[model samples]
Target: MNLPKKAEDAHAALAAAFNTGDVNTVMSMYDVSGFIVPEPGKPVSGAEKFEEAIKGILSIKGKMEIKTVYCLQTGDIAVGRSEWSITDGDEVKVSAKGIEVMIQQNDGSWKILIDHAFGAEASLVA
Candidate 1:
C-alpha cells in the first residue's frame, strides 16, 4: 500500500484500515516514533504501545468513518482536525473529534506524528 501524500488521504486510509480490522495497516500510517492519546489524559507511545492501542479499538468490531474538517500545512508539518464516528450495525458506538499532527518524510509521504483522538475534551476534564 502506498503512503498518503496528504493529510486527508492519511485519515481515509486509517478509516479503511480500521474497517478491515487490520492493526498493522492502521499503524503503518503513523511515524515509527509517533504516539497517540487513545483517551483523556492517557498517552501511548512506541510501536508496541501503538499496536496495542489499535488492537483494542479493532476488538470493538465496528466500522469507522473519518471526516477531515480542517488542515493546515507549514513546511514539513501539518496540523489537522477531524471528526470520527464508529458504528456497529445501525447503532453508533463512538463519535468524537480529534486533532492530528503529521510530518512529511524525506520521501514526500505524510505520517501521523501526534494523534489526539479526544481532542480538546481531554484537556477540559477535571
Candidate 2:
C-alpha cells in the first residue's frame, strides 16, 4: 500500500530510529501530543515520558518492521494497521499486531496520536 508522502517519511524515519535505538530521533517523528503503548510497561505521553520509555526499549536494542497500509485520511487524521516484529538480536522479544492512529501537525509532520499493540506468541496447547 502506498502511504501519503509525509506518512511514508514518518514510517521510514520510525524504522530507522528504531534500528538506531536513538530515542530523540524516534521522538522527533512524533507530535508533542503523541502517545505510545509500551510493551511490558505503561503508556507514555509527551517528550519526557516518551524519552524514558524509549530509553528502556532502546536498552534492549530492538528493531521494528511496519508495513504501510494505504489507509484513507480525514482532515489531519489517518488510520493504519501495522504488523510488527520486534527483535533484540536473534531473539524475538515482541511479536505484535498494532494499530496506529496518526494526526498531522501544523508543520505537516505526522505523529502517533494513539498506538495499541498486541503481543504474539506460540501458545502451548496439548
Model 2 CA RMSD to the hidden true structure, in angstroms: 5.3
Looking at model 1, residue 121 earns an lDDT score of 50
CA lDDT of 103 in candidate 1? 92
Task: Residues 1-126, candidate 2: write the lDDT tens digits.
Answer: 222346545555566667766666767666657677766345678778777877776776567766655445788888766666678678997666656777887767777676654422233111
| Each model's total of backbone clashes | 0, 0
Candidate 1: global Cα-lDDT?
Answer: 0.84
Q: Best TM-score goes to which candidate?
A: 1
Q: Give me the runs in candidate 1 sitting further than 4 Å from their true place.
A: 122-126
- Model 1, residue 20: C-alpha shift (Å): 1.9
For model 2, the local distance difference test gives 0.64
**Error of model 2, residue 48, in angstroms:** 1.6
Kindly list the per-residue Cα lDDT of model 1 for residues 1-126, writing each as its tens digit. Answer: 577887657788778878878778888888859789887678899999998888887887779998988889999999988889899889998878888999998999988999888785545464
List candidate 2 segments past 4 Å from native.
1-4, 88-90, 119-126
Best by lDDT: 1
